[model samples]
Target chain A: MDAGVIPISNTQLALSVILVLITGVISAALRLELLKPLLWGTVRTYLQLTLIGYALTYIFNINNLILIIVIISLMCLVASRTAVRGSPRAGRYSMLLGFFSLWTSTFLVGTIVMVLIISPEPWYSARIAIPIFGMILGNSMNGIALSLERLFSEVKSKISEIEALLSFGASPWESVRDCVKEALRAGMTPTINSLMVVGLVSLPGMMTGQILAGADPQQASRPLPVVVMLMIAAAVAIGCLMLVLLYYKKLFTKEDAIAHYV
Target chain B: MPEFFKFDQIEYHMGAAGRTVKVSSDLEEGSILVIKGPSGAGKTTLLRILARLLECDKGQVFLQGQNWLSFTPQLWRSKINYLAQKPAVFNGTVLDNLKKPFALKIKKDMFNLDEAIDGLRELSLNENLIHQDARTLSGGETARITLLRPILFKPNILLLDEPFASLDDNSARSVMEFLKRWLENETGRGIVMVTHNDIYKDISGIKIQELELSEPGVN
Candidate 1:
């Protein structure tokens, strides 16, 4: 085996398809009815990743600041849409709120990482900024989604208790304080748990990728994961906080009463 | 003089059919306004609207000559409290539930432990019940606790929705008596309650006015 990253040829990539074929065979044998989705998902994975791979290559060569920002903004928009899509109760207000939260938090953390920490030449280099922002955006998207979903569901389930507090003249913030706390906890729990068990439980994807791409294990294992983890933690916290703060207002009417839809 | 504790042209949609109910009424100082209606008549809705917990399609509420919009909802609610039919028993001890209101920034009054204990006594509840987990309280106990919670906050008007629904004859009678005394004890206080129970008729020495709500579009 070569020391540096060995490029996989089309023949080798075709050979990898056998693994999916084997999984498809098992699905057929068990009558699990998953073969259709399995094959479809494999195709989508290949197409999407190949497209992104080519796009990233072009993006890296261009490295224009405006282009990088536009791509990152587009990524944030798509991520925000996906984040709030699963939560039906989140309403239309959440889409805008989710987008703003994701954009703000990801950029805030991404700027810190790209400028002060990684300090890649040009600082906004597409190769560094796009991938780093992508990672932060992905994690923060999941966190915001989970927290927003939890916040809305908890508010729905605890409407009576919330109204009981409101009846005593508690402000909207006071009434939903407990629910907000629960939501923030829910949002951050996965990130915190990952922080606790990273490396021990599972090797993070970026570290493994770097190591495979010929970086030394020691170098791959240190600053990359540390900065990535810290960036994710910060982005997730800021995203979840912004989401709840903005979204909680939508749960009440102008009169401070629980909104009828809620 | 401006009418005390009045709501006019209060309208809200009820049920999936969107039947609209419009209500107009007032409560005199130190009196009881018994809201009488069959089920689904928007009795609970009326109380909620008055409490500003639910918005009315069209209405204006006035307290002590001031419009509802003049005050913040928090201040409006603190002055005119609404107790739900199914009481909200929070986690922790009954005392914690009692003290919960005072923790609000809007509340200026301190939680009076002595008054709370006396309130429990007046409602025929055990003083020791204060230390028990509020979530473990029986339906009747929960109802009384919720009622006591708003009273301790000292709202000028109490909007009650079937407050005696969970209580038995004895508990119901005692609660009614306590409410009667509560009204007479304060010069400016009043109650606008929704109750199908006839127990309020038995209480003497306080003026009780009745507002009967008919089904929407029927009358």
Candidate 2:
């Protein structure tokens, strides 16, 4: 197979460990105490990526749809757990809400990118599907976490204001409308900021990776980063919207009063 | 026939220990019901329950011969409003805060600038305050704005929790006078207030009854 990408040998890969040592040296000089974690992180990154590389090779060759789906679902599950864990104030049902939001958004956005845009063989190719879904999930996980954390904290802090709105005949949705808007804005800001600076202030990882793999700069810049960024934005928006709508109810009682615990 | 605004045997758990407080009372039209209780006696909780802002363990409220369940919570709250002890100032100008209630779908009334300016005057606030940022208002100004918000909405009953807690004596007197005038202005309106201040004693020509809440954890 005449793949344009040049493979890095084991020796060349081993040489990259020196870059981490440079970080370790800085940590030691500054007495930052991050050396141990940095070394451990380096080892884990090497091991995890190597293992995933082998797994991807096998999965890509096998091309089993069920395996691809299970893998995507597992990624979503881990993403949801990580997102919820970042938000300490998230309520008991937050895990469930996080998982549902991530899965739905990733699935919706991933399917659109795959079927409509990429249209890989058999329409569920593991090579394209996994990476795209993983990218969307990673970004949306941060967005959902930020949105949920903001929503919970904002609602708690603004309880009196929310109750005041309720007393003025506002519905539960109406009462927390401002809080929701703030949370949504918090969730969307990072992605929108990145959109503003893409290619100018920063070369995004996807575009850089494609260029490194010997794809034409113009071709790589045109569809890959643009589509991925848009997909991420959509996923983040949908995920935050779904999560907040589902979780805002937890801040209010069935009788439409602010929940005592909140 | 049911008396004008009545709550029967309202039960709520108070404090971390979850002690229950039972409250029951009624208010006549164009009258005032003063809730007297020491600190931690659950006076505010009782008012919140009446406003449907807190779910009572067991109780029923009837407004104008209709059970509270007969009305939606929004409609019930619109008719029976609760003013918190600490005023909630939204992020906007004072006029925007005053006009907030009218923006709700439940309130069909348009905001009256004349009435709002008049309310500011009655509370002894500068009329120009309406253009100021609500967050910049003094404590006394915030309290009066919060009080004026529901008054403009014209609820059937006003459940006030320490409405004069932040006001000076003169301002409190002006607020009391405004509330007295407000109670007398409509046929169906009434007030259920909790205040340690003695200004209610000066409110003449209005029937004033008192409901003293027993201390929490006391049988």
Candidate 3:
């Protein structure tokens, strides 16, 4: 039987609209005011994913290194800007610094994984590089945003305690050490928790996708371990870099005093 | 003239409006600068500006013939300390709180445990309290410990905002006596204590600077 993989035609895909329609109906029945957003989100998701599918197909066919680099850079820029939105009080340079952190960590971790473990032909092949970079960048962006938001909010709420420490002649770093530790922990906890129940509790997106594409189950799950490891490395790198930069940029002034937001 | 710590036409913005308060004074060695006002007269703001926690909108602060603006925050901070009204206690024992200041790179002096205990004794806190958790202490005890911990560094200037508000009459009096003796003995050490109450009225030799809210709308 050809039941190992089930392909969906345009008719089956069109039938998926019923699922979204059901959600919109429920929202209207409940007076949740979510019907508008639900409809818009459904439309956008369909259109965007379709566009991305076409774009990916073209990029993969061309296999030009320059186009891949441009796409990757655009991904980093978008991810960094999204991360910076959570830290509104962060300085003007935050977008630039955020880009640097996201790019460096994702690139470094992604390159090492692709070079050593995956070892795909033409090493920087778009098929392998783009997806791997996407996963690393996406996870690290969340971590960076969470860490920055936590650090800034903690400093604001605990300004008096920070000042108390400063009054004792403690440096800016010493004053905010506790908050920094807490923020870093918060950033890494989600990634670590996912690692705890990878295959047992959930199939995970990458492995599920591979299996759905008709890859052998054993082969499908092979890269999941490396993906998780790369996630941790990228997340830690981004979180640490964000903390260091945020401490220098948002937490302190030119005179090394606590910034006005704090 | 430069030997005295000077606040030259210092102005701090209280809000978006034209609401601003100005304070110009010179704090000489061994002098007590008592900033007197009701609850919302920008008294804490004045002390914060002095502590370098709040930057003033105008003017400059000079200490010992040098512009404090030119000094590093570490240098300015080590010389001038600010005590909050409610006081802040970290998650640790009293001894741990007292030892933290010694960890600062600028504070190279050894942690003087005996001196800390004796100072706490002056504030009616027993030496045994040093081992107890700081967060579990009462309001008065926390205030005393907060005051005691920073003085161990022997900062040149103490910017105290309602240091005695949390204490009762007797405790406040005892604390005042201890502070008086400490100030009299230490020639260059000075204090700027702000209070809504006149509890410190009996203490002599303090230069009173009464503040009035510039904006009628301010709370």
Candidate 4:
């Protein structure tokens, strides 16, 4: 092993220490009124990350396709649920839709880019699967959160106009026309910006990690960058598309009766 | 006549400038009812309750002689036009703003754009203004955009909460005149307005009734 290279475990430990120091400074500066929440957040973040690290160690040992899918599906479900809960009146069905849309869209596109185009992987295996899937899930999670919250609040704040539309003989779509447009705009803006700033502003975390593990900067960055790029673009596209689906799936029941479900 | 919109002994409670104002009133179909009182009189609250925007502690609102609580809020709201003083005019061209309300499915097949434009012309607004962003116009202009919005929906009742309060004298006169014609065309569409400024007080053709938010209910 090269002395210049650090083990992944040591690097992970270094990250945890840095995070604690950063939290200590931020908590002190903000002088948070709710110390309990801050404490909980700190403790929970540490425990969650540690638990995931341990769990992945076991999961990575298994080579079953069914197991890989089951684990990823669980991750996707959790991410989607978290996304829906952030919105007011979002429904349980929205989780299924958001999870399916985000996962399939990004996963399909990410695989195409990862294997065929950029760093070729051997039939969607774990070493490649874990990191790429993580990137997709993370971006999709943020996108879903923003769009859901924005869509709900937009409808709520402009409620008078919505009522006016209803009175005007507008269908539900007419009432939420601007809301769809605005939510899409809000949801996609962040991912669009990150894409715009990829190499210029700073080295992304994944790329940095890959390089720390003695991988060449250019070579190590190949798959990860392609993955991030696709994930971000897909995040925007999927976020916009899924929110609309989430709106339809979560907002209305089978009877054409509309409620603030999502 | 099938009552387009009706409220029967409805009670509403909402914070007005800090204090909660309680209102209990009822109105019949096609009747021009005025909610008259000083500032912070809970007039808007009563209007909001009927409009289904403000959920009350306890009460019943009937639209088209049907219990309001029975139907979904969206269905109930679609049947009534609730226009506030500060109309939400998007930062888009006037055509976009005017055509904005038509995007709803309920109003999709219900409105005529040519008639809407003619209605604009009736308000003394130019056709060219339609191409400009609505924000470029004055508050009165914005109010007109909102007023014309319900024209597409063809709501059974128009709930105006001081629709013309901020307009200058000439604009107010023009707006009221436009409203007069619109009301004439708006058959079975009851006009329920709340205002301290009685700009339409002098209009002799349409009957008008005013009620103050009195004791125990007046905030």
Candidate 5:
């Protein structure tokens, strides 16, 4: 047993199954019908995390820069795909725009944190780089999805207002400027709200995990502020990139008119 | 001699049912063209297409013999204004809503409070309404204010969709009369509208265009 740390064996992990058994029993008693989803979710989470854990362990040992880049690229690609699927009306350019924005913003912030701030030995160390990049991309993906969804929906619902601005000789950008602002603001709300209540209401996972693993409370809290700031920057960057790449013209016809469905 | 405004075979499709609409029309200087139709006939859609808000699957719109698309959207809209059926009242005073058009690049004139008051009077709205919050205004007042605000721009063409849909008979008459006079005084100006009311039926010198959507062997 490592000092100040407790590692769970397979037998100990099996004991944790009792919690799930109790939940399933409650679900059955209530006839909640949530048991299937609960079991499925638990099983899926275990499998996914275990697979990723193995992959990370391999990458960390290999310590090859190219492998790290490939893994990061894969993460960005998957996140972009999720964002594009979430925002259906973002049109044909959604995938490309989503990919570009996620990759650009994540790498920009990830590089800054890895090279400048953390300055880990062998700068691209998988331990620090992977987790940092994952957090940035994960949070930024949610913001991008939310903003893109809001932008398209707002434009669809408020087509008349937008067109009114256009008919008054306002350009396309001028017409939907308010919508863009609103979407960006909406995207930022989650991160901003989380930041507001970070330590008071709930301990963030990273900070809690560091504390549990015998890191000094002060040292663990030191990176919290920086991590939160990086998340916000990444979110804003991805949101703005999506906004810039979106074509307001596509929402209209050749005659410069609004479309029924965006 | 090119017509002031010309559209040929303007078409649009709606929903999964693929219900389609096709329309063609022309307007000369000082002309009033009324678009009339039943629900789902795409009357508003046609006006939207003409206004460049909605795209026509297949069609051509010409402004003074040049393709409408040739002009930038802002330039085209400067010449042709589209008023929605339900006007959106921004979060501000009535005066703010009225003055919003001036914020556009094409509007070079300064805001004239007196002119705006006079315009409001023509719609039977009180001069004091200018200071009132637009979001708090009644539906009829909102419609009147929306219609009047764009007149300040003095566009060559005005495409209105059900402008009178929210107004009382008296207010509708006042607006109709004001529009008639404005058309007469403003030379080469035109109006195209989709309406469900008979307020304009007796108004002399106005042409009506109806769209038929559902009946077999009819259009």
Candidate 6:
């Protein structure tokens, strides 16, 4: 049996069909014509993950290091999209800066630890590397999204504080520096809190799965708890930096000008 | 006269509390502009227009013979300080507010920390308050500190929009007297403050320009 295979057997199919019916009923009660889009998104997610999972299984069998790197790059693109919807037009250069700052930091640090520090295999396998990359990327995407939204609204709402600084002869950077810091702080707080209570509260998903597969509980859990911590910490630091940099770009123009959006 | 500061047929759109207003006025150099109306006469707009913080639907502001057409707004902002009716304090200490102008590399060479303390004294604020968090200050203290920050920078012109609205009689009188004296000594520099101090009736030799807001909005 494959470590990560989740086959849509008869019982699973029945459950999925029921879920679809319930979704339709909920949409109709809300008077929203979004049942089809909802189904489409779910179906897309299922099909996409299924194909990618099978493809990655083969790539992992081969144990090709180059293939793993390519997949990680593709995941970075997906992470960037999740961070900012229609981002470049909203603020030019934010998309690229956010994408690089987030994906590169988290991905590089995560890959190094998982591959170099702990596993020390012949080559990094896609099945393990890709999934780990996805986990880190997903958490980073959420962090970036929350920070970007809060950062902009903070700037827009506190136009007075910003203008007060400007009117008192401060530059755009000086005026908005504190707002940007608060925005990043809001984004990173959740991940930091989760880290504080990780092992005491519950056994994490990776550790549990490895134990289920007949691996030594202590051996399986040992490396994973540390790796998980590293990925999350990387995600937070990278996510915070990306948002602050993006926000700076959002507030100012080529002339070091503050936008009079409000 | 190069009209040290002038608003040539300038219009203004300003927001206060939750209400917004639009007004238009022309400001001359070295004018002690008094904006008197019952309440909500868009007096702040007159000051914001001069400061270039509030937008004007139509018209131009000129300072030192330029129509304000090309100066980088940051550079222009470095020149004029607008004191608001209800002053806002930033999240840090009073010293952060005082060192506000030093943030701009363009204005760094011109900033003097000593001048900031002196200005605080002139506004009757305790020198020790410089290290205090802004949130700890009262409405009156905050207002004076707000006034103190801009004055120390000594912008080319001062655009005060009802700065005394939140102060007591003694504090208001003292603030105005100190400001008036400072304006008198600076050549080619101007102070245009909006106030409802009807008692001044006519302050001796002060250039008082009055504007009544009763005109219809331009469609």
**Candidate topping TM-score:** 1
TM-score of every candidate relative to the true structure: 0.95, 0.92, 0.90, 0.68, 0.87, 0.73
Model 5, position A212: C-alpha lDDT score: 77
Candidate number of the best DockQ: 1
TM-score of chain B of 5: 0.91
lDDT of 2 by residue, B1-219 (tens): 559988887888887888889877888888999999888888888888888888889989999889999899999999999898886888899998999888888975688989999888888789999899999988888889999999988899999998989888988988888888998887899999999999978767768989888865342
Q: Write the per-residue lDDT of candidate 3 for residues B1-219, one digit (tens) a residue.
A: 456677778887765565677767777777777777655668888898888877887888888888987878888888888888877777789998888778778876588888998898888888999999988999888888888876888888888888888889888877877777777776678888886556667777654444444444332
Winner by lDDT between candidate 6 and candidate 1 = 1
Evaluated on chain B only, candidate 1 has a TM-score of 0.96
The residue ranges of model 5 lying beyond 4 angstroms of the native Cα positions read: A18-34, A223-256, B9-22, B37-39, B108-110, B201-219
lDDT of 1 by residue, B1-76 (tens): 8888888888889989899997888889989999988888889988888888888899899998899999988988
The TM-scores of chain A alone, one per candidate, are 0.91, 0.89, 0.87, 0.80, 0.84, 0.83
Model 2 lDDT vs. the true structure? Answer: 0.89
Q: Which stretches of candidate 3 lie over 4 Å from their true place?
A: A1-5, A21-33, A91-93, A223-228, A243-248, B204-219
| Number of colliding residue pairs in model 2 | 0
In the order shown, the candidates' Cα RMSDs to the true structure are 2.1, 2.5, 3.3, 6.1, 3.4, 5.9
Ranking by DockQ: 1, 2, 5, 3, 6, 4
Deviation in angstroms for A178 in model 1?
Answer: 1.0
Q: Could you tell which candidate, 2 or 3, scores higher by DockQ?
A: 2
DockQ of each: 0.89, 0.81, 0.68, 0.26, 0.68, 0.38
Writing each residue's lDDT as its tens digit, candidate 4 over B110-203 gives 4576877887888888877778877778877877777876655666777888877767888878877776666677566677888766677777
Model 2 chain A: weakest 10-residue lDDT segment is A85-94
Q: lDDT by residue for model 1 over A1-262, one digit each (tens)?
A: 3667869999999999899999999999999999999999989999989999999999999999999999999999999998999787757788999999999999998998999999988999898898799899999999999999899889989988899999999999999999999999999999999999999997777998888889888988997898898889999999999999989999998888888787
lDDT of 5 by residue, B6-44 (tens): 888777886567877777778877767777767777777
> Fnat of the models, one by one?
0.92, 0.84, 0.73, 0.41, 0.84, 0.53
Using lDDT as the measure, the top candidate is 1
Q: In model 2, which residue pairs have backbone atoms overlapping below 3 Å? A: none
Tens digits of per-residue lDDT for model 3, A151-238: 7777887877787888776788888888887778767777777777777888777888778878888887876655655566565666
**Whole-model lDDT per candidate:** 0.90, 0.89, 0.78, 0.68, 0.78, 0.71
